[model samples]
Target: VNIDYLKKHADELKRVAASVLTGTVTASLLINKLQSYPRQNNLMYVLQSYGQLVKTIFICKYLLQLPLRHRINTQLNKGEQLHNLRVYLWFGGDGIIRKKQEKQQQVTARCLNLLTNIVMVWNTVYIQEILKQLQKEGYQVDEKDLEHISPAPFEHINRLGKYDFNDEIRLQENGLRALRPPVDKR
Candidate 1:
């Protein structure tokens, strides 16, 4: 973090930890060497930075796993989207509902839970009907693929602003198309 300190470790200071961490043994050896040198707070910016550098390197390494990272990102995004959907259904989520009062928190939390439960119940029926319809159209449907499908995007509910509460709904045609596995073209 200082002039001469950085001047000493200049090359390393410029190089990212991930590049160093690419070598498994190199990272460990460097870490051990940094540890064994001495224990001083400011003197060990190089040492302290190694932790972050190694983590960055580790993350960089995993970043190469395009499919794996994409899958994880998508699953995480799905969870976030479901939360957003719940917030849409309940108006107290001004994007910061977690910091709300205890009563509002309890009510919203309970309502979200209740909504999740209802969606779960409806999801089973929706998948079954989708499979039935797909088979009826001569496309072979697999039951296993529907195992993780949720009904979050089934937006045909009656929860618009300043309207009468009606629970009846109609299915959207394209809801489960992507979720269905490729047709057994054999």
Candidate 2:
């Protein structure tokens, strides 16, 4: 609860956090290498360790982001680590063999892979839902609306042929016209 105490500990906390981040990144890279081949039980332990490293780094970063004098939420912190560990153990570990025993085998290489897939799926669903809500609010996507958008003047100039600046101007003007809506709409 003491502001001075928190400030005094900040440097130590930052150093610990940096080391955790370094470990997490390093482990993540190694896991990526392992994932290129078939899953094995031995690899699971490595991935679990990597997952723990990632969880540790994430927690440290989360705590560091919080305001000084604010106590970290113990339950939330534990929940995040447990969730990550579960995902590591269940989806990223020897789950492949277990799934085979159940007559269904699906493979995931590492905790990072599982986490990435989850995030991607969630992001896709979230974007679709947001688009639906936007449409419901009367927002519409129009291809023709984007016609007025053009490269910056400098960009256009840079794209010109080595010895043909005039030709570039003509090309740009023609491109703009092509982007416009057709005049003879039925």
> What C-alpha lDDT does candidate 1 achieve relative to the native structure?
0.64
Clashing pairs in 1: 18-57
* Over 4 Å off, model 2: 1-109, 143-186
Score every model by TM-score: 0.45, 0.20
Write down the lDDT that model 2 would get: 0.47
For residues 1-186, write the lDDT of model 1, one tens digit per residue.
Answer: 234655677576556455575654476676566678756544358656555666777688778888667667667767876786676667655645584589987886787789876875666666677677788889976765553455566465556557744555443674543344546879
Question: In order, what lDDT does every prediction score?
Answer: 0.64, 0.47
RMSD of each: 11.6, 19.0
- Which candidate number has the best lDDT? 1
- Lowest lDDT 10-mer window, candidate 1? 169-178
Off by over 4 Å in 1: 1-61, 92-104, 142-150, 161-186
lDDT of 2 at 112: 43
